[model samples]
Target: MFDIQEIRSQFSILDREVNGKPLVYLDNAATSQKPNSVLDVCHAYYTELNANVHRGIHTLSQLATEEMELSRRKIQKFINAEHDFEVIFTKGTTEGLNLISYILTQKLQKDDEIIISYLEHHSNIVPWQLLCERTGAKLRVIPIDENGILQLDYFDQFLSEKTKVVSVNQVSNALGIVNPIEEIIAKTRKNTDAYVVIDGAQSAPHFNIDVQKMDCDFFVFSGHKMYAPMGTGILYGKREILEALPPFHGGGEMIATCSFDGTTYAGLPFKYEAGTPNVGGNIALGAAVDFMNRVGHENIQNHENALLEYAQRHLLEIEGLKVYGEKAKRTGVVSFNLEGVGISSDVGMILDKMGIAVRTGHHCTQPIMEFFNIAGTVRASFAVYNTFEEIDLLVEGVKKAQRMLS
Candidate 1:
């Protein structure tokens, strides 16, 4: 039922060549390439429906507003949120995390604790650190093992009645480990009344998310990581929780009425979404969501899981190559290093020369690098369009890098 070639044909960039070879885009963990459907929808939005949302009374404004709100509904359905208004448009996962931190920390008191994990992206970590500095809250970290899995047992020891918030990534961007978020959320609830926030920037691309089932207070993800354009993402919060939190940014759109005496903020999502939004990008993001639903996430998961397995099996064939985070569950990412490779960037450059794209360096998780006791590892992340043959090319490229750099 799953047609790999049909799926590949939808992405126009896959036909292009880089450095005289077909581009094997394995850098999906950074940002995914867009499909023609998303591109076409974006073009149509700009060409036909280019107008500001909410404030416009003209026909174009009404149409644009409809599309923008439609995208919110689409995201709500995609994540199975209880209410469409719970989905707030954000620039991306980073902005969502920062917004959540800023609003939630207002409730914190001195000596209140915020719990995070060692597997978190810097986006998930730094905002909490800044929040702690602002509110005098203590930042607690749940450690991970050498295999890159979280030491979940330690979560009980850190979480207490004083814990105000708990932020974690559902998937590690650097290591591609699928964290036990459901279990984590359940445990956090048992220990304290902390608000649980999940960073789904990586996991959203590979798995189906049901916020109602997961029962997390806040969930955030980037559209670019899941075949949508950059500068578009979503933040889903419980309706009451969002209403309770103060406005993140203040401006024209987020306010209900402004007077010389006082100002009242808009209801639900609009209170948090200040200023003009990216209407075109958000519509395209809706199209991207539709594309995923059309293709079916189950098919995407099966195909990507197969690719991950194939890549891991073949990559291990090379001598002195060490793969990080061989956890029980993972997404379509492989971060590895050759025994003799002095720097990850060198290996990445060599792979690029061969038209194999991968991510190098600390990947914005310096804490993860510190745990690994290395600078970084070369990461090759797959998407739905990627094939096993591309994985072969990547393996060969890694072997070539090992030989040439050694």
Candidate 2:
């Protein structure tokens, strides 16, 4: 059995009341509530080891460097990367995706193709589009099925010699759909020499990620969504591919030596991490990895799956209510809207009044909304501390709203 109360105590902010009522923070997909251990690790970094990393001869500076390098090793084991240098600390998923686009476009010639999917967040889509515009390379999109799953039939037809890269979300952020990435990569690789990039932002937190088994060329995920501090992300690329790729930016740590004639770039992690990186945030991510290990992801996955099933059934039972991505055994997330609500934000606001928080709007997947013929869906995402009683409360709240409006 999952200990809801035990997990609740781990998050300090979860204890606070919202709108004079006990807070039911269903807005976890936006960002998760961090545990005290994660917070304390971040705090300890500033208090004990505050210094710029990699360039200091002082005691504190050496300690800071130790912490950052150790953090990299932790991330290596966290995602089970083949090599430690393959893990690059980024600002977040947005930066990681942008780095891929920047690196690929620098190498690809005109007419080269990088395929993405409609299920991707705007962060994944816009950067590649920008890169395509710069390089005169075309951006191809793999269409999705009616249920928000990626259409593999269309995917096979799209992959060819022209395809140089394939970037996809492992889990749809807006739809709560787990993509068939392993199969997609297998077939896509069979057809041509395209690099496979998996956005594990949603999947990393909920499930155990074994990139070796997946064989994705690149993997990206944000730290904040994984119970770590914001301002940190992980980019795990195959070592040879990463070494062959050009650096995304030029600056302080990323240079071997500066000269008016020419400049040589730094090696590996330093090459990708241009300037002063988030030392404290990177250390906190290590703590998050430790936290997840302590509380087994199997337990986390089972708990959340139960919540998703219960919430999906309850949401559909209500009049004129529809739950999108009604995939059984999905990660504990539901995207839906009430009938005749007209605007999801209105419903979201009302739910907030009752101390039930939810996310509203296109959820950074405007293309997905366009494909579904919906402006947006009200999203209620779950975490470990979330309960069946909370789902019951949400059902009651929605029923109250429906009746009041009727």
Candidate 3:
């Protein structure tokens, strides 16, 4: 059985007050609050095992190296990768995508195309843009419907022999719609030889991820979005593909040997991880994986689904309040705007004064905002610890904003 209160107790930040009212945190899509277990593990790493990995022969270095690799293995099993070395440690999803884009510069030629969707975060979009600018490749975008779901039928028009890569997010951060990635991958395989990439940043905390089953050539997600610390993330690539690609950064740990004449690179993961990694952050990420395993994905899904449904139902009842992606399948996010509020940030400020935290603005997807012909939407995203009562508070807060602004 999943105990709501027991789960809430694990996140101590939920107990704090904001502006003299009990804090209701709903900005989870940006970053999640870390659990006590993740916090404790991070502290223990700094206190007990503070040494550089793979360089020193001392006891602390050995222990630190073991813990860091152990974290890599934990992520490997969590995502069901074929090999532990395929799970490369990255700073976050942005860096992972940038690394891939940098390496592909050698492969992509003039007029080669890279496809992405209307729902991607800027991290997924800009790197490809840079790649196109550098390599003389063309960047194509798959359009979306009015309801914020991808229009998969239009995807065929974009797929061709010139296509070299197809990268998309599994979930939209601005609208919170879960995309049809499996179907997209299937269609891509049928049409072209392009490598498929899935940005799992928004979906990793809410659902189970099996990269083997998904069959994407690359999958990337951030630990900070899933109860782990910032500056830690994962980039899982197929071993053969990773081996074929050149190293993104050339530095100390990523080298086999160095001389004035020439230099050779190291093995699979170390090739991508050049400098000293965030050993404690990665260990905390492992602890976060363990925490999620203990609580179970089924429970997380059910609880978050409940929160989403309750929030949608309540928020939509307000006069002139519009919720984006209301008709589409989504996870734990609700983006809406009040009728009279000129800017979404006004609503967010009003909510914050009432101790209701939400995110407002373009949400790093300015194209999405431009598509809707609006500045931005107020986004309230839920996590495992959020409750029905919090949704009630959000409803009242939105109503208050509406009355005050309109």
Q: How many backbone clashes does candidate 2 have?
A: 0
RMSD (Cα, Å) for all candidates, in order, is 0.8, 1.3, 0.7
Tens digit per residue, CA lDDT, model 1, 22-120: 999999999999999999999998899899999879999999999988988999999999999999999999999999999986799899999999998
* Model 2: lDDT of residue 280: 97
The residue-by-residue lDDT of candidate 3 on 276-388, one tens digit each, is 99989998899999999999999999999999999999888897989999999999899999887889999999999989999999999999999999999999999998999
Poorest stretch of ten by lDDT in candidate 2: 324-333
Candidate 3 regions off by >4 Å? none
Q: What is the Cα-based TM-score of model 1?
A: 0.99
Error of 1 at 13 (Å): 0.8
Q: Which pairs clash (backbone N, Cα, C closer than 3 Å) in model 2?
A: none
What are the runs in model 1 whose C-alpha is more than 4 Å off? none
- Which lDDT tens digits does candidate 2 get at residues 300-330? 8889889998998888998799887675225
**Candidate 3 clashing pairs, residues 3+ apart or interchain:** none
